[model samples]
Target chain A: MTRILVSEVGPRDGLQSIKQVMPLEAKKAWIAAEAAAGVQEIEVGSFVPPALLPQMADTAELVAFARTLPGLNVVALVPNAKGAARAVEAGVHGMSIPFSMSETHSIRNVRKDHPAMLAEIRAVAEIASAGGVHFAVGLSTAFGCTLEGAVSEDAVVHLAEAAAEAGAQEFSLSDTTGYADPAQVRRLIRKVRGAVGDMLTSLHLHNTRGLGLANALAGLDEGITTLDASLGGLGGCPYAPGASGNLVTEDLVLMLNAMGLDTGINLEKLLEVRTILRDALPDEPLYGFTPDAGPMLDYNERIAK
Target chain B: MTRILVSEVGPRDGLQSIKQVMPLEAKKAWIAAEAAAGVQEIEVGSFVPPALLPQMADTAELVAFARTLPGLNVVALVPNAKGAARAVEAGVHGMSIPFSMSETHSIRNVRKDHPAMLAEIRAVAEIASAGGVHFAVGLSTAFGCTLEGAVSEDAVVHLAEAAAEAGAQEFSLSDTTGYADPAQVRRLIRKVRGAVGDMLTSLHLHNTRGLGLANALAGLDEGITTLDASLGGLGGCPYAPGASGNLVTEDLVLMLNAMGLDTGINLEKLLEVRTILRDALPDEPLYGFTPDAGPMLDYNERIAK
Candidate 1:
């Protein structure tokens, strides 16, 4: 069976966009439940300043709690070297920094231009390497940008080369604006792979325009292994304007398992974890069709049969 | 440009599952607006008995009105020889009949088993041939059925062959219960084609599990051309329990156009058509991401750039 790494980014990304912070206990329960459900990787939190995003203020605590789960790959987002240092100190297994492909978006998001962001990535790579942590640079807005519009494919390839040269261990192409389609996904993945070889293995996609799963399918066709998704697709990035939730984790897992790919996720158990979020964040709307519709009637039979 | 035939099925499929009967004028307006938006084909309505589905009672009237539009290939669903005769009299450019792959679903949907359904297909095919109306057989529940779990792929291929032998001019695989995944879609399309050759050209998928577009992408990968979608994913078949809605047309067209495929659909004009359905069916809910989020910022540049 083909195995795909489904990286859960709900606790960090999903909570980041919400107005109220998820209670720490609820966060711990969500992470533990997901880990128990065979989700091996979880982006527990971001090491950003608490002042800018209070919802992520409890990220370090989440990291610590998630790390206790055996076989769980605890990961966090680090926007700069300062955040990278904090994440390393938090003892995260992996750290990813968003490298916006659009210079305009890069400045607005991290308050750094391309050169400065590259330097920061270098600095973070050094810190993560020293701390024995896996570090990845996420090419955010790689598809297109709302602020700048039409981000160039050449620029994305060039930046991947630069980031790889800057000591980035792995790369993730992010459709932060949900502007990606399957055709672009297939073409871009091949182009970036041409630049950085097999380092480009992950994809961070959005469903704002309803092509998230389709784009992920394209990524899979190009041999992308790790896919980032939020439980219920609850989060839209604050920095990416008009962006909606990341691909719904439940839906993505459902499709993966249905395709006879082993995601190691027991979908029913993963679904139960949603109740914690529901009770904790009562007003927040959870999104995903598989959860609403439940698994297909012949869930065990698989789609191929 | 890779021209894709986006056959709008909202008038027939969308209305079939709804509770309230749409006014004839509203249906006319919806069909006309979509045609004006450059949609070349539309399944105007079903020719079922009015008592069974009053929502489709206006199918003949719709076919008459839709045929008036230049370049519009007006179509309707005919469940039996009687309905097929009526569809022929109504002068539809095309007519389709649903042939459920699962016998349980077939019995429940149309009160016909495989052998009986084959007879019905032969009778309707003769009528369609005599009347010079283009006829298609939609292999409903080809993916899997709610009534029966794990529909055999061999069964689907066999039915397509049987239908073809019965004079089905063309064949379409329908995910009536939305159990299809991308891998299964690619596999089944190839298998059915092995049995029926290139005559299997269209896909009628449901978005129940959020894999609708992904499955469509898989079909596209296999060179399947025509895609069936509803205007807003508004209707689902009342017969196919647990089935939600057909693939949303607005989102599908947006993805197709974004991928640089010529769908001939002016998305902005297509979005305008939703207002007619919204106003005419005040209580009905409209579903689609592109309409809710509008098109991407760089909608014109296409994803490849």
Candidate 2:
């Protein structure tokens, strides 16, 4: 089976939902632990203003530290042209601009509509290109939006194509509000992949509707090889922060491994990272099935003796 | 999308595991309520002796009562020739015999080895054939057996063929001790299906390994249509008594419906059935997800005008 890359966004996505701010050292430790657990990419933190999201304030420090780890792709979430400049200056592998496809969510999340955000994405791409940093447009609410109700597939395709035209090296669809069903997922992904064939198609899905793994499977059927998952399934949008925002990384990794697909992630090692993270933020309600349920019949046994 | 059949087996498989016998009326009410909840087929009760399982002592009466309901395929579990004869005489729409592939489980469960059990199946088939009753042989321990470890794929295929030769109309593979991983499930189902292609392949899985839904998806991918689930995941082998067994019906139904595969069972009516069942066994643990997590975004909007 061709291996799939799982980007653990727990530190960035999972921690941001949590009220407590993990120490910069603890964040670095978590990143190292995750990299050792075979996580290829780690979205260490977001580049929003510290005043807005104190939890992600140490993003630059964490990213700089993460870059020292060999073979680790450190990506950061940049909200606009300013954050994109910071990510470029930090010299990470890639930076993602949150491109909201829903008009309402775009106005609420980034205070800009689709066309204006596309302009920012184009500028971010130019800045990243100048610095030789990869640019990925993370399109949030490609699935339906809670604020806007149902997001159009036409809107999603149009945004993805716009990002590609704006010089984005890659594109990923996020189920920010998690209203995606598998059929809609399959339909939208096919449309987007057709619009941007080889410019790196990926998905960032949430299990809000309990369809994270199902949506991932649909994307897989559409030839999407990269998937975004948060450890313990964390992350709540400021407007609607809840337990349903991001897909839990441990559960997603478990599904892929159980499907006989190599994810380079040892579930045992990955599960341990949750504990390390929990120690820093004890009140965080960590979510995942495989972690709490334990391994499916001695996954450790096969790995052990 | 073909509306997949989800046969609720909580009353029979789920309740039988506990020490307390939900009174005869409770079993009848559970059957009627689940039928009212749009569950098309249900294994209402097993025809085992009251001496062996006092919890299901009133199964015969429940079966007779369930038969009066409109459009319900009431099924009963028959461990040996005696139970099958009793179920057929009681006028059930379907009668299923548990044929353990493991010599150890067969010896423990029914006191008959594989071939001897084949003789018993043929005996029941002859008895049911005369009465024009539908017969299904569930290949219990088709995936590894707890007592007799590593049940060979050939042994499972052999039992499936034996049951078919003995004149059974339907076949299902159980994750008896919940040892099935999806890859293993896919392999065994393929082998069994190749042995009896399109011979009414069903899946009887457990959440003991926390991979029940994942295993169900594997079965669906392999073309096994019918899924057996217990409401609230109330199940454990009554052979030991007072322990939980079987996958939760609520979780399983939610998973299938979420994946866009239509299961005729309604989530709301299913929850209502649980309430009525709760009156019978107040302290008994009834498990399910859709009940706990509420409906998905605009579930009623999706359902209503």
Candidate 3:
């Protein structure tokens, strides 16, 4: 396929960064709108505990609602075996468990060590296989870590191979702290892709360093077919202070379509989805260039088959 | 110099599109504050008649005031040979006269045909030579024309060569209607650079097509050094309802700086200039990303020499 599928992660990745927590039904509406916009897959919610991340407590309900959509693939983030069990039982199309390469980052983000994370990946994979849900491992800090600094690409590639061996069917590289440049991105992605082979490799990038889209472009140039973006530039990193984490979905789709790549997403309808999220979280800021710039006169319309 | 010059043209290109005319003195203050922010070059006003463009009556006075600033390259837009003469007399560092290759755009904008417009460029060149001032030619509608549609790349390359031959020290490609894409930009820039070499370079782009930054990135990849932007994403063609012209200067510079391309601009200081423009033209809308999303903490300190 010439068109790469752009999966929006605003509700899950974007919402938790900001202080505002969207209600469950409002999230369902947001997911429904994004589904209508032809977003092939969406990370609907995270399965983090309510005490830890109050913003994403409605994962079970939201995933079930998203699954009802005809062609939409519902995805969820699971931190450990418990969240993985919930995601698999809730019937999400795909489940991703994060593995931070940096030992320090693993402790800070998940309260687990590297070996514990690897064991948890095996647990999540077992749950996914039994429940018939897709299993993947997201290697955050695959490029560089904010806490420790200078994550080697060798460790990242080694981790991907480890996750695959642990029964993870897919692999993804994320620039968790956004320290990636285009050159670094090309080098790392090439290395990772070569290691992972064709296990549906993808990227989950944050725009913390403002290299989000540029790094994403590098990934695309390296033959990556799956990209994760938030509707607005809603990266919302806690350490980042008033910044959106993921690259802006609208801007990324615009870039892909304008380059003659088939995204199968309508620019106008996708922007309309922004209004749905805006209504739900009125205080949270939404960001993207294309919506503000408006669609070009010849923006191709998308037919949701 | 390795530093690229990003000239802000919002007060002129941006305000002229609005029905309301921003006060002349406020316009001057905007330029002044922008210069203070280390915006070395600012297109303070356009040299159009008061009846046609009542928004910019005090351009000559603005140019004079802008010249008073230490180490700033003050610029003005000259529509024809007459505006060039005034700009030369006012003693601005540089001025640009827009030449539309599209016959329909030329007729609608300046009420002249292509051959006659060629005569006007010759006149402006002679005036600049006598008055001892620098003159550049901006070929507007170089990408495509709204009225005539699908402007030929050959036509743009030829006009660029002719402008350079007629004593234009610098030439800027105008995507007056924002009809440029990245691949198209790489192709056309390569074609023009082949024809006119370094003399035919610089980009005056619009984000109307949502491809402004992408087109700019493509231009940079092709070794383009100078970029023209308006402050606050201001400016549109009054005749063309939805057509905004000129990429937002602050946002574009932010992208370049974040990419480690030195533009000799401090983002925080550049952001301060937006407030002056916003206060001056309360009725006019200004657009920029970096202003809303504050600059990275060590950004200026890290980049500063």
DockQ of each: 0.75, 0.34, 0.18
**Residue-by-residue lDDT tens digits, candidate 1, A46-155:** 99999998988888888888888999999999989999999988989999999999999999987899999999999999999999999999999999988988988988
Candidate 1's residue-wise lDDT over B50-149, tens digit each?
A: 9988888888888888889999999899999999999999999999999999999999888899999999999999999999999999999998888888
Candidate whose DockQ is highest: 1
TM-score of chain B of each: 0.98, 0.94, 0.93
| Model 2 stretches astray by more than 4 angstroms | A241-245, A292-294, A297-305, B147-150, B238-246, B258-260, B297-305
lDDT tens digits, residue span A29-64, model 2: 889998999999999999999999999888988988
Most TM-score-accurate candidate:
1
Better of 2 and 3 by lDDT: 2
Residue B6: error of model 2 in Å? 1.2
Model 2 chain A weakest lDDT span, ten residues long: A296-305
C-alpha lDDT (0 to 100) for residue B221 of candidate 3:
69
Judge candidate 3 at residue A42 and give its lDDT: 93
Candidate 2 accuracy as lDDT: 0.79
Off by over 4 Å in 1: A297-305, B297-305
TM-score of each: 0.98, 0.91, 0.82
TM-score of candidate 2 to 2 decimals: 0.91
Docking class of 2: acceptable
Summarize candidate 3's per-residue lDDT along A245-293 as a digit string, tens digits: 5788988888777666788988778888887777877887776667756
The Cα local distance difference test for each model comes to 0.91, 0.79, 0.77
Candidate 1 chain A lowest-lDDT run of ten: A296-305
